[model samples]
Target chain A: MYRISYKAFKFEAKDALLYRIDPRAKLFVALYSMTISIITFDLTTLILLTIYLMIYISLLGKILRKIMRNLLVLTPLIIIIFLANYLVTFNIITSLVPAVKLITLVLSMNIFFLTTSPDDFSLTLEKLGVPLTITLAFSLSLRFIIVLSKQLNEITEAQLSRGYTLDRGGLIQRIKNFIPILVPMIVLSIKRSIDIAETLEVRGFRTDVKHTPYHDLKTTRRDVVFTLSSIVSITIFYYPLQDILSLFIPL
Target chain B: MIEFRNVWFKYDEEGDFILRNINLTIKRGEVISILGDNGSGKTTLIKHMNGLLKPTKGDVYVDGENTRDKPISELSRKVAIVFQYPEKMFFSPSVEEELKATLKNFGLEGEELNNRLEEILEEFRLVDLRDRTPFSLSGGEQRRLSIAIALSWDPDYVILDEPTTGLDGYSRRDLTKTIEKVLAKNKTVVIVTHDLEYLFEFAPRVILLSRGAIVFQGSFKELLENEDVIMRNGLESPKISMLMKVVRRDGGGCGMRYSELLSVIIERLGCSEDV
Candidate 1:
């Protein structure tokens, strides 16, 4: 099996517009966008929001490549949703709207995460009054998502090299082929977690004491303006504008 | 024999080439080592040997069959790779079951399968751990089990990637002895490693890569003599080689094992009577 590279989640250190914004502002934008996208059933509003997010992501330069790669991975799921809906409802054209909406929501989240590093994400959580232990747990989980996938990929390759064929099997047989891979992956993850815990203990990580960050997050004028505009736009779209549009446009 | 002709590779079309214009031939039963710094494409090159990766341009031939023509499963019968963290691949409840499953993939069954499994367990010194789960073994034992699983099918070519990583002094010696056993069976062995000491002692022919190209390809002695190439590639000479350089006042000969170094020192000190 080919290893899937989760390039989008990897941090980009370049100085782009999104990267330069305060992590809190970006996190707020992401949360707002996701909330607005979920509440609005209007296809036009979703399309407009998707276009806006697309334009913003396009401006991220090198990070745009990672976002595009992530979008490629989402293609199969989007296709499956569309096909399932069409099969059930027997309406191909209308069924696509939900799939497109899901894609837009994913793109909105990807835009935020692809630009923000894990360090900045934890800082955002800390700034939002999350417990230090929770913030540390969140950051460690994010880091290990990448690490565990790499371990899985290596394990898959190693098994394949040992003359283990994963392809060409019935459904049950195919899943059975993964037993060797899954068992080792779970075992390795447990081992890694123990190692991480020991390392934290050795480093004297304490939940009781207040911890200071290396890079202090300060909101600049650009961040303030972006955050305010995003909140206002999402507010207008989710409330009055959607209500007014729904009255004129049938359902 | 494995051959690469004008082979070039990149993971993405827009990405920088990882292996550029690699042309080389490894004859049957030849033991060779590939040395390179991180990101120098050592792993990428060996991945091509077993059809894990296909060249973007040109071709790779394993035993006169183009890698592109065969599936990885088919190519794997001719070449087996034991990855650095091979222990992570174990899934069988016991070591015997693990070997049995691998041999099953090669279409062995019944009495033949049991016999092959017994032989492999004996060869890797893993008979004592036959009933134990592979995950429960020590690090060194796990490594040996990994190699044993790879060799269960008896592929003509065995490639190891960074075998010495995370191995202790005794474990490293065990790995060396295992490789010696593989080589004794007249199997072609290819190793990709940063362990200069292992390479010096075991590999007679070394290919040094820098920036996706071979910079030096010769015996260890030639590599030692060309200090500029070694330094440029960010590699350190083996410890014994460095010590010999200091004592002899000039780099006369490079030694890997302790006994070789002792003999060199004795010869240098004019103690022929003892010899």
Candidate 2:
């Protein structure tokens, strides 16, 4: 279950400051961070951006632990990238840059997702001029990921109770053990998908019709201030901050 | 025997405890029914028996070993749990294979394994469905198969979580008979359920839980006699028990079974009419 929490997209309805932030503002922050990470080749800028995202995530309080756990799942991939880069460049500093960049990218996305609920995310997408179908599809996919993972965990435990050892044996043997889990998950998911489609049909869901949304995204003064501050910070990091730091850091 | 010493559990560290300071001791060969409303921590309590979950505070000792010390597979040899919606756990192509896999897990092989497999299939009345795909079986058959798979190794303790959820009357009766057969073998049974009527008929000892605390632990008769406890816990007494309550209120003796209650009512009516 923890393995799939990163994709769960749960909405915590708490009175926290981060929870009250507008989804649109969070989304822009995510986009700006990603753009900066992608365009900035200098290591100093990437490191600074990574630090900023880390501090932003720390402010999330309870959600910070979940975000960290989700990031732990990416640790192996980050290490692999670091090793691959080191093998090619034979320089420790250059090798570390790609790992930092990957971390910055993931942390930025996590900031958006961990703080924003699925409903808010879809509403943000809808307000951003995305078609309703695409937004629905996105939300539905996120929902199914959590559902399927839960089903998988249940199936795994069921087999485990029957004396099946999933963690034993070699890699191929472990994959073979997962057959019992995967088969039921796929079958159940297909059955669930059919049920969902039937329910949608019964509820009069039509792709051609323009539907009225019950909840509309509203931006407050906080959203404007947050978005502007994020853009400004990104601009500073992308333009002058890296050059100023480079004089002393030797990057 | 299973014992929980001041167990407290919550999924999140800072979240309110789901099972709070739960202290219990379940003896061997005793059929105990855990009754509670939703979110009362019934499921969380039973999962401790098999080491699927360890206590956030205190300890869960199975047989004499702390559950925290052993893996679930090691604990499973003694405690088997058939979860609610057990059919969703089925992954085998055929019913026979499912039971076979469980027996194999317990290291049973050759003639002994085959004998146990055949015996459980016949015991659960799944002989005809032995070759059928587990998913293709009817709901009752699927549930029976799930129980059969759990019992293939003949664990000393069997836990059923809401075994009658979607079962029809006939299936429910069949399940009760199956449970009776298991009890006849003297295997300790623990059932977590909302089916009070079934609990009234089968389980001798009832443990009522509310908000992660055990409010009552006694016989069905004691539970029936306490209207305040039953009503407060949001539980409806069995129909026979309710009738018995009405009879006792009018100065008639209480009876747990329908036949006994009917006789009491007839005796009361005859005496009143004669006067």
Candidate 3:
């Protein structure tokens, strides 16, 4: 119902500031954080990374609650990680370090995803010389995430009218209730994706022949600034010997 | 001309047949309006025209040529299909690009493309919104853009599935004008609509489909004369037609044309022509 108000699955980086920055730069920052978090297993390093992520969310992004809501799926896994570390590790410090690192990585991923729209990510990929086919596939999958969420609600409503109940049911019963909704949603998503792919292929998107975009995607100076800053941050964080830190690194 | 011979379709092998043994033909320069209930395979029947969905049993022919032997790009050049929901095709941002994408894909360029595009844009009155984002347009604007894009290729046959949906009175009126232009040019137009009012207003030959078969095929006027046929087939005559029947039953007047219907009202209401 709200797809239109939510821009109905269109180019909706509506926050004026968000739109000003180069899409490619935002994409670089997302990727850089992910890479930096994964390379370090030290507790101090992980904490510093988390602090940076927290500051970024609080200052630059201002999407803390929104990211938390998106990370709901990872919450249980996070709990499991904490429990597993408690039960399995000999060194409390060692176990906690990897756990913190993983959490930082997950949080960084959330920020990256939150800031960078699929259009930007694809543009970045295209610039990186990734094949057009792979970039297009990645885009469709990302587009499906937004489209399917809206569809899932409608399917559930239709199922409810048809005597399928999800209310007050135990785990098994709820699982049974989900079958009808999931079957149609996934089936329709796959069908529509293939249908759209066929439409694009017919329109000459997948072929080697060059075609102009219906909408222009200009590479702006902000994108350049974003790339330089991210590259500098990534270099500093990647090298253990380097002392490059945030000027406001809160030392 | 469009022809469907023994066309059968099922969603899957294990599923019930959605369309069965459908044999029908729509001749060139003839307007056909299809009316059916919700699950009466209205969309499924027309989706075959553009090769969006292929027949599971037999073949569909466009302009006397069998579609099974032709690629969709070739078929698309002859048969332009407007979907039930026009918003689904709105992948492009602006209206100009939306129509140009069709021409571009066909490798059309230069002054020829620009001239042809400007002509359609003016005819449809979408010239003002040529550079505006398609997604940001009103529902009516979107529907009109859908029609304009379909006409961009100038296909011999234009198929519209519920074109007036989500449109207001003025937009619908302009679209009727556009439809008349298509008719004047002798292009075959196949409209799938349950709007009996429009069917009556346009007076196209009606083809009523029920359970994947063409049950009635005749002029709209002749079909409305049979009460039993309309009732049995879950169809209703337009409000104007029903009103005309009530007036005709009272032995008042015998006016059939829309102008005649209006003049009949003028005479009955005692309005002087030169007053």
Candidate 4:
């Protein structure tokens, strides 16, 4: 059974410096890293981004452990990506490149999510002029990950106890075996969604009304310094320093 | 027989133990009811019986074999678990197909499979709904189908986790009948439940757990006699039981059943002749 704690990627109320910084700054850092990760095929750049996020995570105190634990959940996808790439190119280093890029992307995004509460993240999106509906959807999705994973765990255990072997079948048969697992998951998801919709309706949840943030988010001097420094360093590295590093790294 | 030898478990390495020093023996052909409030390690305890979870500190032995050394699929052949939500396991196109899928998992096929399928469909009263999708069945029918699927493989031990949860009066009665049928087959039935009223009626071997520890384990009558253990564990006795206690405290005597309490009330009111 997968005993994944629901609090792995959740934001905790901590007295760390990361929590003091504005969610907007964290969002920018995450977005900037993701944009760079997507735009560049350079392994050195991705490695550098990974190293930068690692430093940022360490500065947030003991959150790196939780972030690493959550990353294990992505291991299967990483291996699949590596195998698909190696099958086509037959180059080990080239296969490693995409996997490293994916890791870097996850590292950056997880840092932002771990430090920002859903309400704060929602408010930050609203501050950036996004629609209220989209912001609420994003926030609710983050909260729903725990619920969905828990439901998935329960369904898997229920099936396993009925003597259903997940590993007995060939590729097609293995996929077919998941029908017993997936059908219940979908049914439960629909039921839960209906329950949630009814709950929200009863609580007077509406898009037409302007909803205020539960906690007022104010950008302190720390956020300004952190945001400006991140932008300046990223611009300097992406434009000039990246070329210098690429020469030495020989990607 | 199943045995837990000083078993202790926690889902996370750094987390608090969910089941602490749990040592109990479930003999063959006996009914065991695990009683606790929510999160009192009731479900976690039963999961160890089927090798779904291994003890973190001690050992659990199923029929003299260590659960830690056995795969869940192998142990599942000896133990069947019916989870609280029946819909969480239903996936086949039809009710009959769902039972067939479970039976096939245990290596049954051909004539034997057909016989087992027919038997389960008939036993659960699902013959009329055999061709219907499991999702199309009513709540009680879906519950019976889930139990039927679990019992399709003819496992030696059956675990029902919150079997009566979200069930109506008639559905609860149907579940009681199902439990009686399982016991009649000489299967060891273990139930994790909070339905004390139903427990009072069924009166199985009650094991009370409090904060991951077994506070009491005996017959249902013994549990009612010691109300302190029940209250200390954040549980309330059945209404009939509470009423009996109240009457006894007032120097009046009553039994732990509704009919007994009713007769006592009539006797105390001096209205036996009026009835």
Candidate 5:
């Protein structure tokens, strides 16, 4: 009931080789291209990078419509950034280039978060020797989001039964509407986290213990090759791929 | 035999003790039952059998092996606890795989694993559901699948806590018959139940618990003869056990099996003259 969207996200990523790709690989290509896109103010380059990101995220099995839907939520905020850039620099091309960079960077992160389950992603971080505290922070915060959404619904229902009109509130007013949802949810989640931690301990969860995953994540050779190829595509596009195409078209 | 000598347990340190200075023994080949009111710590005590919960003070031993001293995987080989709402025990996808996983966890995989799995699935009438997802099955089918997984591991001491909690009459009988079959295999079954109506018919011993401690640990017949004790504990005599009381004659007793009680009823009515 909580983040019911995760079900649809799971269905999308079930076919995602890019998601199925090693986390290191996704980090290497997606993060690196995004960094380059930020440094350059070339409008043509930003457009190319955006196309690359769309194709890359599409490899996660999402269609154009799905990607646009997610982007639509950010469109208004993105337009605000474009307007701010236009006023600050008064260079329309300059503002447009960074705006595209901004959009691509956010899209890359969306791809990362959407395709990966918190469990697998955390385990991936752990395997890479991330600090226990850092991994735990990510795990608990992300886990909290899914659980908090569920608690929000439960709290709303309970309050509605008691004659609270959580449904009738403006954006600022909703902040006040959150006293019931916020207090009980935080209190309940902390208590529940403690109880669940105890339960996991009883079932033998230890930071120091070296145990195989009950459901192991084993990657095939195809996953390996495809990930390597995506990283090369990003690097080559930053230099050789774009240059090679320029010699032919002179654009 | 299972023994708890001076057992003291609390769900947490500095918390009120759930079971205080408890002393109990279940002899080998004996059918022992546990009874209690709500919040009586019946489940807390049962979990101590397999080291799922450790005692804060003293010890719980299952067949001379101290529970806290062994790893769960090892202790599980000796004592299997079927929890209340048995269907929830399965975390596996399909019934066959769920049964297979327990056998595998006990290091019982391979042809012998496949063979034993088939045999138990057949015994539990779960062969038809061997490929079916367990969570999608009916409530009764789900319960049967849970028992089949527990038995598939082939543990010695089986501890069941309120296994019939949410079951209907038909499912309850189905579970009881499965327990009887386990008994026929000479396994020591420790049943923690509040309802003795069915257990008194199929299982002989009915251990009574009052406030986290055993008040009585003996036959159901002894329970009926002591109505003051039953009433004081807020219990009613099971109907079949009460019906058998009329034919006690001189030395006979109530709490006979359903078939035996039926025969006694017919004989008292002079309806058994033909047989």
Candidate 6:
């Protein structure tokens, strides 16, 4: 019942300063960091930003551990990105730039998703003038990801219980073995989508009406402090700070 | 026999236990019903029997083999679990191909595979729909096909998780017949369900779980006898059982089914009508 509230990004109800910041400020930080990480190609600056993210995460209490766990799952993707960049550029230092940028982006966003509640994030979107339907669509897709992963796990178990061995065969045979799992997944996914749509209708969901949010969002001093620090950190990446830091810390 | 010896399980190390110290035994050929409210670990218990999940603290033994020692595929040769949603198990192009795939997975081939395929299709009344894709079949037909796939390999223990969910009266009757067939084969069938009426009809041995502990386990008649156990667990007794409770309060004897309950009520009223 509480899977959605607690399982998404392993959000914890903490008393930390990061948890107290306005979700709108947190969202700006996450998206802005992602934008900078994509545009800026300096490997030294990226690594320094990654270090800053790690330090920032440590200040949030035990969330650093959870963030590391999420990043571990993305290690393979990071390696693939690194390899692809290396094959094209043939420069070790240049290849490290994209990988370091991904780590920084993931770390920065993990702070947002881990600290902010789903309701708060949706409200942030609405506060920024997004339509209710679009916000619901976005939030529902994120929520259903947990459901889909769970369904996939159950389907895999069901197939295994039928004595189906996925790892025992040749490449062609192994790919063929996935059919039993894939078909059921597709069928269940379709059924789940229909059920969700029906539920929305039954619950009187409408796209035409305006909604009054229950909780009033208030931006406190912590949010202001967080936003200022985030802006300062973003600026530090562009100035003589990068030049000075690159001399001290070799890439 | 399936033995759960002090079995305790949690999904992760930091998570709370879902099944705690569940020391229970299910003998061969015995029809068992596992009852519990949602999140009380009914599905988790059945998953343990099939070796799909391993107990975190203790051991589960199926047919003298420790589940912790065997892979799920190896343990599944002895235990077949038909999940609540049958659609999650279908990936074949057609119903016949589905059965053939399961049989082939069990290492059957040639004439034996073809024979088992035809036999299962005929038994489940899927021979007519055998050419249809599983996704195209009706809900009841899909359920039947899923059960047929499970039974085709002839496992010693068959577990049905909420087999009656979304099934109509006719489809439930079909499920009853299927359960009867499984029992007649002398195979142990375990049903994890919330359908009390279905359980009353069969009156199988029941294990009631609450808060990760087995609160009650005995014959269904004994379970009905202890209305407090059922009520305390926030589960309603089957309607017939509730009606009989009123009858028994007014000096009627025990009965589980409708026919038996009718005779008991008539005897208590001291009236008989010729039909």
- Which candidate has the top score in DockQ? 4
Off by over 4 Å in 2: A1-9, A13-22, A56-66, A127-131, A219-222, B248-255, B258-275
- DockQ of all models, two decimals each: 0.72, 0.64, 0.02, 0.78, 0.01, 0.75
Per-model C-alpha RMSD:
3.6, 3.7, 19.9, 4.5, 23.2, 4.2
Clash number by candidate, in order: 0, 0, 1, 0, 0, 0
lDDT, residue A161, candidate 2 = 67
lDDT of 1 by residue, B1-275 (tens): 99999999998777899999999999999888899999999999999999988999989999999999998888998899988776777888999998888888789999999989889989999989999988888778888998887788888999989988888989988988898899999999998987787775573688999889988898877787787887789787666677867755644456444566667678778887466
- Per-candidate Cα lDDT values, in order, are 0.82, 0.81, 0.70, 0.84, 0.70, 0.84
Reference-based TM-score of each model:
0.88, 0.89, 0.52, 0.82, 0.52, 0.84
> What lDDT is obtained when candidate 4 is compared to the true structure?
0.84
B127-193: candidate 4 lDDT, tens digit per residue: 9999999888877777888888888888899999998888889988888788889989999999889
Which parts of model 4 have CA positions greater than 4 angstroms off? Answer: A1-8, A31-53, A69-107, A225-251, B243-275
Q: Between candidates 1 and 6, name the one with more favorable lDDT.
A: 6
Using TM-score as the yardstick, the better of models 2 and 3 is: 2
- As for model 5, its CA RMSD to the true structure in angstroms is 23.2
State the DockQ, from 0 to 1, for candidate 3.
0.02
- Judged by TM-score, which candidate is best? 2
Model 5: per-residue Cα lDDT over A97-204, one tens digit each:
767877878776665666677777777787787866578678777777666665555454333322234444698876765564565565566767888789878986
lDDT of 4 by residue, A31-97 (tens): 8878887887877777777777777677764478877776798999999999999999999888888
- Write the number of the candidate with greater lDDT, choosing between 3 and 6: 6
Instruction: Judge candidate 5 against the unseen true structure and give its global Cα lDDT, from 0 to 1.
Output: 0.70
Residue A234 of model 6, lDDT score: 74
TM-score, candidate 4, is: 0.82
lDDT of candidate 3 over B1-275, digit per residue (tens): 78899999975565688888888888999888988777888888987785656788999988777777765666777888776666555545578876775666556798888888888889888999989977678877877887887777778988888887877888787778788888888999998987777665567788888877778888877777765677777777556876677667655332254656666666767887642
Write the residue-wise lDDT of candidate 1 on A102-179 in tens digits. 977887787568778888888888989999888889999999888987887788877777767777689999998888
